[model samples]
Target: MSNEQENPLLQYIFNNPEEFARNLTKIAENSGKALAAYLEPRESGRVQDETPEELSLAVKTLAQVGEYWMKDPARAIEAQTRLWTGYMHVWNNTLKRMAGEDSAPTITPAPGDKRFRDAEWEENQFFDFVKQMYLQTTQWAEHLVEGATDVDEHTRHKAAFYVRQITNAMAPSNFILTNPELLRETMTSNGENLVKGMEMLAEDIKAGNGEVKLRQSDPSSFEIGKNVANTPGKVIAQNDVCQLIQYEPQTEQVYKRPILVVPPWINKYYILDLNEEKSFIRWMVEQGHTVFVISWVNPDERQSQKSFEHYMQEGIFMALDTIQKTTQQSTVNAIGYCVGGTLLAIALAYMAKTGQKDRVATVTFLTTQVDFVHSGDLRVFVDEEQIKLLEDRMNKQGYLDGSKMATAFNMLRSNDLIWPYVINNYIRGKEPFPFDLLFWNSDATRLPAANHSFYLRNCYLTNNLAKGELEIDGIKIDLKDVEIPVYNLATREDHIAPAISVLEGSHCFGGPVEYVLAGSGHIAGVVNPPHKNKYQYWTNDGLHRDINDWLNTAEEHPGSWWPHWQEWITDKDNTLVKARKPGARRVKILEDAPGSYVKVRL
Candidate 1:
């Protein structure tokens, strides 16, 4: 008992060995009595046979216990003690079950699960130690209940509450909270480190370069011509995200027909034209679609006065006006991504509500959500208190900081992007690898505090979008009122905008909604063109249907959904005409391919 004092449960088990042994004797006596009754059979045609070997074994067991039986007084005392101990064990176990807590199984103390003799030995020792401790504690608890001096209805209830409280106090959660070392290790591991290191690197780069890099116009990987800006037919349209260079045939000109690309102000529009290999915008240009992307101005403190109504008017509606005038086309195919998609949906709804849908011929939404309910975990950070705090902070600064927006995104993948780099670069003196995606991820945009707060509270927190209760510029917007041909793309692995949540948009839209499920997260899914490693999509029969029904018939395929999308768009427009420019009489060229608004710094 002294040696076992290090573990209280083990000490209890050791101190009660006699009582345990006595219980074994009692169980044996009960077994013998049952066997003797079985040996007696009523007079009938049926014969109950007892094996000689079994009868001999039972007789031998009874003979051994006969000595204890003769010492009746001592044996009776021991049996009573064992019964009390068993009762204690049952009571403790009942309390544990009610608490919904688990006693974790023992684990081997090694670097990994690799097996060796020492590992096996350690595993056995750990499990044995835990098992012994559990049995002793259970027995002690059971014994107390069985030996209660005053047992009545009220007393029993009081005892039960005490047992539960004791069980809870001794629960495993206490150990978890006290383990700071484990918490430190977990928070500092994996992708978290990369994000933190990338953040620092982004700051250094932004400080040195002043503005994020915009790739010069380039042709799609699938295009036959070179993507060089100086190339004969290399058409350049620069935005803050990147420079989209289009290579069209000498005969195929963009001065005739136009295609408008609308991206959310939250992110740069370059996702459509990330690079020649992966750029969807580049592919459309090569496929003879006159691509006109909206290069959103990166807002700053000066633009803090800009409101949601301004974004729709100056940002999207203005772009549409320019595209229409430049191309001399009455309507254009407008594709929006993320927040841009939400904006596009708003514009489409506005057009529908106003009894006007002619300017926009086709609309596509990439990972956009109309319903607030399925907005996923992004809702966590947009509660009333958080929104108010952000509004106050942003109002002071005029616009929400770009780096701050990036911080929120990195928090979503903290284990993958924040703390790991904090430990490696800040704590461990390690240099991070320069990854292109990380660089792109670090490039963020600013939003007006008033606008951002309104969006978070009205769209996400309140879910006014799907309810047809969303108001833009004092005008109630209803998506169902819109009769435009709509295309919605959702990614399966998008944590920011989950597929389940994004699908709500299809239901909210009154138009012919074609919802497609793409592969990968938000960015990769949309940027994925018809490349070898690209993923496939699932769609219904071009009719608006429930999400589950579409999934049931949806087969998984590989490569991007862009090709399928292009086919769908082409089918809507059967006539092939030369690409045209915005032919408005009074509109003047504002800037080069990419605009100045995208270049503003924090």
Candidate 2:
């Protein structure tokens, strides 16, 4: 044996290679046996054994689809004729443009499409043909989905989604011949752009292990407590899971009840406190409300054993205790965002079950979901097979890498989030511009194996949380037990947490609920500031079981939802008291706002 001190596992394998190989073979044999047993019944030609009535129903459905298409033969013929005519016109226009005889084309790129923005795209015949072909293909796909009268709505929706993905993937801009900017760069740089791009590709491969780095900003440029998360405050408490940050009051008098923000640990907490101008934390403080945020640690292998219960205990529960003690308040308003909101909901249920209902004054959820039935496109990736694959990977690493999780999220919006950066950085050979939101997005945090696995299995796969089967520290939680008044906000275009899912989550609570639908996606909706005069929101006092009914009956307001939230939260008690400084006599200050934990990177 080698002199090196081998670990027990390695030592055994080294000493008994034959035995290890035999054992491995046996394990594979067992797995194959299990798989065969599972698949045997499924592959037994069950469909072939269907009764005559079932066969007839299947045939009838096919016939109905054919008849529906045939019924509109004349209209379809007309549409086909128009399409051919348009194609011919495009061809003729392209020839004329090439010959320098026409200023305008018969067909043009659609509005908001930056792909064909370069003059060469319209001026060059080959490029114009490519763009026209792509546009026509997408239009045809959309028309097919829209005109399918006999197909079920679900099938049509799924077909449209896949078709869109296909079209996006095959975009001409993704290639060199059709991309004018890329072609120009190649020529002007004498292939230096390609060399530079290769270097960038190599760097990204080394940094991300084959995953592309999409964000345009330099992370080092932005420092915590300097440029980002600069809101003046102090860390009142610290633990292995989280640090409680108490912001300095901007006003002399503040609300008696403080507000605690529970941001998701999946990302850094500085998202809410990006800078002085855009910081939601600063805005909350300036509004004369004492604000406290939980900055979760960027966990690694050392914290691999941490569970969701650990987060509940050392994160929200600990923060709440510190807030109550520091402010000398019996109850306080609490807010949770995304996954943090999910945690907060569970915490509230646990408290209610333990007869601590009076600990929280009001609960606010921002783009959060308690029910996962319609959790949007993300649900498609959560299943027995997928979870098992993920678990195997997590088991090896001790924690789920943030970059891997980020890649999955990026794929959800591949056209917007993934392809754009690929084209800009790899094809065009340009660096991404520094944007605060994108910078914050690139800063992701790892999830400990124990906590992540439990969350995925219990909440996602089995949906135990919604079913009231989710347990933390041996206590089962039921959202219905949460009797406090609730405020829920959902974004209209959020694919991560669908608006309907958020609305459905509100139904879980027994108490009165106020729900608002804000414009934009998950992060943008919550970070919306009133002064910018951007994005509208919808509000309805009544909570209806049907999401559409609520949307239809709701009143639309053209402004940020922050003012509305302020009105709702402050309406209960308008009384203001003298502002209390950070780190009261009870709890000593640990560090400044955006504290040490938030600064830790993977």
Candidate 3:
């Protein structure tokens, strides 16, 4: 008569007790491996203990906001009352909906919320109540943070960020008991999913050497050079910092100016060369460009002494020298993405200081920042308190582990990146589908101590580059001195480099800037190809204004901005030259395309 009895788990448990017991035993064994995977590294002293500052920073930041409410009794009581009111409404709605009144939800999930996609989160009374309660509780939490206005700007941002992390971890969708889809699967499989999931947990822990490296895609399904980054090219030259690869030309006659790509070292350059369909590098080659990309080395203790000056001198500048020799050209067009763009901007200033500004004829900055005034949430983790802690950790190994940066980026979009994997892989015991972008995302690279430290201190911490206070190799470089034509691109919904920050950087430049806005976030927006036509782009209506002002009068174009970029680049210099091979002129071919450097995995 009872629902539990009628829908009994493992309906034939009495007959299938043998298989059930075997699965339970497997789970127990796998759980032991996971524990051992975490402890063995510490026992052997292979991994050092990190400072407690990381944990304390979150606590202290939250305390600042808590102190705001504690100072006023009315504020504290009002927050509690607000929470209780929301709970009461959720309860009332649950009762009405249970009685078949079609009662509307007390609060709805945000537009793109994928958590409540299951019909049971709404059609079923119990699950619906749980979903509404979670939404209401999130609203209450948001109210508490918003009301703490007395908190300083940075501290408040950190508190709100911490709150979101805590709330995301507590979402009901993360647990099998609270998630309808997970619960149904658990019961249907008689808990075999839990056993397999435990096995996976142990594997990931072992792979990370005591940390959990959640598998975002089926790793077995993809390889870097074979599937994901398989573009036709050859490595022309290599140094300690990077290897320069020149793609085989797709067109008989290519643009005279060779394009050298300076990609961020935080992640692999394959993001721009994902696959045939999504390959931005391949697309550029097809657009009659002789594409050359610098594949930065994954750092180690050997590169501990490498600084920002060294990266400019060895990485970007070295690639520029090689590009000139390989293409037999005096000048080249340059493209810089993210942090790489920042370096190119610095190099431009340095070039101007040395009277060599014409080395790179025209430049393009893709989601790069010279000013950090409006730098997004990443700033919350870059304060003196945290950077000091980070430096201390880096001193132990000479390089910041790639995973540390990767984890921080994921935290920015925890609901989409972290929780979803926790549910699908750990709870549902299903492997995620093969996705090129996520595969590239998981492939992170280490950051050398000197380079990372100087960057954080100068750019993120001090905003020196914008103020002309940045000194490189004992030279005070100025952006205004290097007045070359620039094509500045910013993604509309970027979390790392916000459009406003990119817009502000446009003002810092002393040249004519052709600013364009693309729809989507950092990666997707930049990598979009014209044929795919996935997203739209906006160009200013021949007026120079701020982001908001420009958006109001911008000309919206359908599809990717690649075609427009091709047109813009060619108009500058449409002269055609015979397609150049990887090592036709001077630089000797060192290796095949994608290079040995990118094949080095973390």
Candidate 4:
């Protein structure tokens, strides 16, 4: 064979040596400049001096895993043996492929694992071997963590989570050399991709003030009021904690009982109103239901002392009062998403204890958790040590930076959320397409110190709400007392609020509970509009203790939960009243919404 035929890379370089060298120089030049962006912050004292709190936690957690494994050398050695044997199989397979023989992969990516979805991962022998070996190593490490019986559950959970994050970061696809697509791009562009990537890295580091603010979507494409959260509403009431938005009526008549949607303060409410077609808020209004949503303020040091109770007082209570005055309705139907649902549950219990049970006639919880005993991996960060460290950090800023919470959430599904962005934005040198959901995701809100601290200690750490031990304003509130009708929705594939956790939490409600399971994660499952008819939900007349049992007997239905929810809520009282305008009676319109609160960027 000719020398050029022996190596395609050499042939390409031989054809365009000057271009190749220029690209290499560009890559080297930009690589050094990226560091300057990061270092500038340190020089100005903008970056903190101490070690990251998460790194410390990971080290401590991994130590426990090591301790457990070291106690049983035989088991540890066996795990190593399994890994080596797997590697040997991959080695033999790669050898066979090189010799022009067909060889099946030793291991493959798990179902729904998108990381290796690229065709090159399975089609190319070299990439296949690399993928299989990595999978085996990850599986072995996971099994080792699982076998660490001596390690406590909390330690084990942390170790497992930390390990996944590390493995994800170290994935073959993350690096240009191992990633076939990235490699092809680099060669074709003559290393220009790396230069562009480095420039982006520097800009991102500057954007995050020393941390990589991984851009998930083109932020320039969408504006809060212009495109997202544009469901035609007016902010009629305002408080320190939230802005009460009353959407304009789309139908001539609406249900007698208005729906007050209390979305989690952690995320902007636009997820439900990404656009007119997908907007749950728009659909609700179209279905002849008066809908009002709480737009939580992006808090700062001034709002640091805002406790959980204050959110209820200034958020839900204030909205409810506004709804009553506007429509002259005695009661309202309540909808709470995620943490907002938990707060609503607490508020309902408090109201019942204080003899104000008539204010909220019915309650619907979307991906909400009252009981946190099995709250999944989020509980790993709730222990005394981490919480104290977190509290101290929050104290310094008077509120936890929204980015920290955003990063923690992204960690839960790091492969889906984190690594993809890293590869696309940092390695491939590509800007992501405009995605509304991702834009809203990047728009994070600060958590007040007192509120966050109380929530962590009470709900996540102690499980007080489920135990009937949670107190509000010196009153011990019991969920058993707030026995109005309940519609509890849990998403099937939710990482933030697991279906099992939601099922377990249903036991806390004293009312006749109708538990429904929706397909997809926390956001998509709930925001699914009937128009799109994407995903499915399950309904069971009975609430079973085990989630599997509930699923086994449940009736599966196609389409969104919004229509199902509409049917359920309206079934209680379908009395038609003339649709009321924003700030109808007593209240005055503060401003047109997607309100100023929703527009506040951290």
Better of 1 and 2 by lDDT: 2
Per-residue C-alpha lDDT of model 3 across residues 1-602, encoded as one tens digit per residue: 86546764433233455776888898899899999998999899897656466778888988888888888999888888899999999999988877778777899999999988987788667778888898899888877777788888888888889999988898888887778788877766767888888888888999999889988988888987899889999998888999999999989999999999999999899999999988989999998999999999999999998999999999988888888777778689999999999999999999999978889889999999989999998998888888898898888889999999999999999988888987778777888888888989999899999899999999999999999999998999888876888999999999999999998888887888888999999999999988787899999845454677889889999999988988889989989988888888767889898999998878
Deviation (Å) of 319 in candidate 1: 1.1
lDDT of 2 by residue, 4-41 (tens): 24432231123444554554454455445444544444
Which is superior by lDDT, 2 or 3? 3
**TM-score of structure candidate 2:** 0.79
lDDT of 2 at 77: 81
Relative to the unseen true structure, what is the C-alpha lDDT of residue 27 in candidate 2, on a scale of 0 to 100? Answer: 45
After aligning candidate 1 to the native by TM-score, how far in Å is the CA of 107 from where it should be?
Answer: 7.2
lDDT of each: 0.58, 0.79, 0.88, 0.88
Candidate 1's error at 435, in angstroms? Answer: 2.8
lDDT comparing candidate 2 with the true structure: 0.79
Give model 1's TM-score versus the native structure. Answer: 0.61
- What TM-score goes with each of the models? 0.61, 0.79, 0.96, 0.96
What is the lDDT, from 0 to 100, of the residue 82 in candidate 4?
Answer: 82
